[model samples]
Target: MNEDNAEQGVIRLLRAAAHTVGPGGRLPSVRTIMAELRVSPVTVQHAMRRLTAEGVIEVRASKGAFAATRRPTSEVPDLEWQSVALGAKPPGDESLRDLLTVPGPEMVPMSGGYLDPELQSVAALGAALGRAARRPEAWARGPVEGREELRAWFARQAGGAFRAGDMVVCPGGQAALSTAFRALTEPGDPVLVEAPTYLGAIATARSAGLRVVPVPADADGVRPDLLNAAFARTGAKVFYCQPLYANPHGAVLSRERRPEVLAVLAKHGAFLIEDDFARDLVIDGTPPPPLAADDIHGHVIYLRSLTKSAAPGLRVAAIGARGAAGARLRSARVMDDFFVAGPLQLAALEISVIASMAASPHLAAAGAEGPPRRAAHGVGGQTPPTPARHDPVGRHAGVGPPAGRRRRRRTDGSRRGPRRGRLRRPALVRGRPAGPAPAPDVRRRAARGVDRRRAPAGRRGRGRGDTSRIVNLRPTFPVVIPAHR
Candidate 1:
């Protein structure tokens, strides 16, 4: 009803074009138009909503918006349709420029509000298309809880300890994560983050009406004493971690310190949310257990995404939760999207999942002597399917494990580690000594783990393909497993 001339002018003309040229006239994409008009997506979305309601243009599900036919029109444009269509000019790089008319050097193109294009993938497009094709209904309005089957799949894939009932799906990690923060704390609440942590988490916290406490971590791991002291000082309720292959530096947490960090959380009576992106991609040693495995009390909450390994476009992430935590997240998701989503780009997911699968072998290889840590909970003994681990741990006596990983024993008795979890290097066996440890302490030389029993004769986990020194990071939060049946 607030349709002033300024608001209606362009919409009226655009609607007229849609009426005459047919819905296939290909109106300017939201991106192209936004850049050209310097309008926000919300503005465009609002206008488009009106157009769709009026039946002037039919918004295609999953695909681009289309002009709906059956509107009364006096005249329809003929030749050079686009030039005269929408009363707008064509854009460059129709693919990308649609988002921005080529941002100036200082502008730093930012659409989707958050997320960097640097990490976006083209494969996501193909995946979404494929999904839309198979599940034609994917383009239609959907359930508030998401496809129950998909949600069930997510629950099933949660680290071994969880159940299908404990899972809830969300549009993205940001939503799931923000919901968690909002549920757990009040405004100005104290929370933990790795120093030089994922900036997005920092931004996410601030935007969600909360406060944060950043913990400093070295190559070995976060300083437990510092964490304990910080908790004593701030008395925070929640702790955030990207333990396994944390974003940015990709540092793996050392085993020696995993328990120490967990102890700090336990002492503080705080909850943990583990993010297992890199850990999921392990191709080398068996995957490690999640920090939630150590949970005797209901304090750990696991949140993972199909996005990192599957495809960001999937906008599909799952919450592996326990007790009241999972329920809180589910409620938040409902409030946010009411379980309703647009024609999902299910196609984009396959690309990431496939890529993640391909990298799995290398991820395992890159880990330490032991297999990757298992999530405290698992899905029918599956290694909690995921992607993104890299190859290397050093001589291979001992290096710190990857980010936030906990510790474990390897098949050949070598060290396997993850966020908040890790293991000691396999000691000598029999009369032989494996070569020096693979990795060195951050302050020392690379001294990796050695297995006199498993080492090739007197040779330790040395040479290529040796994970003797590699360590995987654990996600920042604690994940939990539940009973599905």
Candidate 2:
């Protein structure tokens, strides 16, 4: 028999066997099915694939096919008791869920907060991962604080003041934020955050059982006056902020206000969690030094991540602090995941080095352009200037004289005045203004009975007109007829 006939025959037999054995019962082996049906192995395998896809059976690897479970449609299980057992704590993962959701193929994502796949350095990441896998100690566990070289790299990126020992490598920025929140504040302790801050940070703070308070921010960054007021009002010991290209707002704290903000934190004797997440994404020019760079009193706890500029899967970040705060963060990291996987840490280190090397040329070029201009509002420093406007005649609006009065170079390389012609005015058709009249050459062509509909794509035609005096008409013309007969 043909292959299709054999497949159908085997499917029918399997259905019968499933009904007899019921759910979770093993069906006949592939060999047995082939022999019983007197069919070739290919036919039996094809039938099995169809059965598995249709939910009639499940083929376990290296094991025979088994009947799939079929739940009764009329009776739904009671999940009410579990809710009472779980208590009344609200679900706190909505923000994270939104962040982690993968958009469908049809979606044009305007808002998920990550580098586009095209923007991520895929080749560098792949190379790093490959090199890491080949390393002798790739699988071995390293220091819980992270590799010394990797920590040193992060320290160097921050500035000359920080040291490798002051840093604790975490799985990612989100984990670093969560660990910092739990280590720095007790349950119900208030944590001050910039109003309209990173949603992930808010979720992490709440998950760590800390109360979040909003401090209003402007173009430059978080308002120092309001920040001090928030500290006095709520007695919040910890403040979380992104000083460089802050999420959502993209505000970089101004040079003048940085000192003021830091002084406020010092006055309140509170810790500032500086999330320097976008240090590498400054496309136009060099960003100002991180808030942690000038910190002398160990007031700044810095968090930097490679996952945004690099690929998403490279979830490596560093948290830098000094004194007891740093110690507590290290302990929290240990308790959280023991240590990040060795291969991943090594891969992250390789990628960081490669990315920094790649960015050096761009940084040098940007340096040559001098520093970026500060924003008038003083919030996000160095905003790009607004583009120049253009006039209807295709010249820059406020630029030197009109296009017709300008000089032009002839084919023989001599400068001559621009050739001027009578500009066509827009015609009023059907009590509405129409587009400008066609040029003289186009009117001559129309006079020769050339079909306007046969004009090239994107060219529009006016209605019928005389050869001598060209009268442009609207595309649609109203027909008038007398009442006859």
Candidate 3:
């Protein structure tokens, strides 16, 4: 009669029916069980749920529940021989693994290498992906070098002499780095990297069997002298560096040091793998051009990625080189994953997506306008002669200074500058300076006249029986607090 008793009775009847029907037989319908047992549908559903969870029955959508099939158990086989067949443990990148490990819900992550989920343009990216999915070409296999349009856009981003023909679209920055490492060097060859470079680069190089040699870097980026020394000492053919906003340190290679770095590479006849990962993340001031832009003889192999600026799912990156080096990178990319997914490549280059990303506050500062406007918009048809000061998606989108006012910046990101005169005070406050305090009014005071001279010291000028004190909350700031008796 009760819910629990009814449920148990229904479950018992269903079990008997299943036994009678044998395995894989249809169980009694909920309506039939309810009609025969005189029980509610909830009771029947509860019993069915219990049976389903216990694997005593299987529920198929549209079709009624049926008895579950019982398969015979087999003996477990040992996998110990796998270790012997695989031989010694391959080098483990514990740091890289830890970097990629996601934290639990209770944990607040401070170590994640990617942009915070709060800052990602999830809605825009999703919409773009949806649009891309509808295209017939998105499902088709793209060129191994990547979609032509995407490559051309990357060329524009790279600036310099790099062209669409020179670009190889890879899955992401990490994959591009791995492909470059494998393509350029043989196993056990020394590859020079900044001392505190991106861990993914180190992990990729080591995984590719290349010996990583560290070249010290400072606030201005990798030290030219030390880099030169390392190249001479190790005879390394490849040197990886982050020119703008280097990972971990946020160091931008200084104007003075950029030429020196290139000279060092040229002297050693080595290649510089410039990872311009943060090119689009410039919050203030103009970003410098990629080191690859200055290279005429192909000493620089440039890499630019949208993964950081856009959502992490937009793992599109361009790895580019010139002449023979470019061919090697393209060949290497073909062997690794063949080509990036067509939908992802198309999404990155889609005009709608590019416009959406440019307008997104997550990608740029709110209300930032004016440009070579080319950089702020999508790169579709022709390539520009020079790269824009910032990545199109990551350009600083702050409004420029008003006419005749020179803009200056402060540590807190507030704008300060010279103005013609003091700002007009509110007239409603009777010509008195507008601030936290109320303006003087003789009429108001006279009407509510209470002799301030006769009032208690603590209550003077304040409402009746005021016992408040202004406390100095030192080390933070002073605030008015009420001191009750």
The lDDT of model 1 is 0.50
In model 1, which regions exceed 4 Å deviation?
A: 1-128, 133-143, 280-287, 340-485
Each prediction's whole-model lDDT (CA)? 0.50, 0.62, 0.63
Choose the strongest candidate by lDDT: 3
Off by over 4 Å in 3: 1-77, 351-360, 366-485
> Candidate 1 lDDT, tens digit per residue, 407-479?
3222222212211123232211110101121222111111134321132222333322222231211211111
lDDT of 2 by residue, 68-116 (tens): 9887789888999998999987625453553344533322222344444
lDDT: worst 10-residue window of model 2: 475-484
lDDT of 3 by residue, 252-364 (tens): 78899988998998898999999988776555477888888888889999998888777777888999999889999998887778888888887787633354544657656
Candidate 3 has a TM-score of 0.65
Where does candidate 1 have its weakest 10-residue lDDT segment?
Answer: 428-437
Model 1 per-residue lDDT at 331: 77
Tell me the spans in candidate 2 whose CA falls farther than 4 Å from its real position: 1-75, 91-93, 352-485
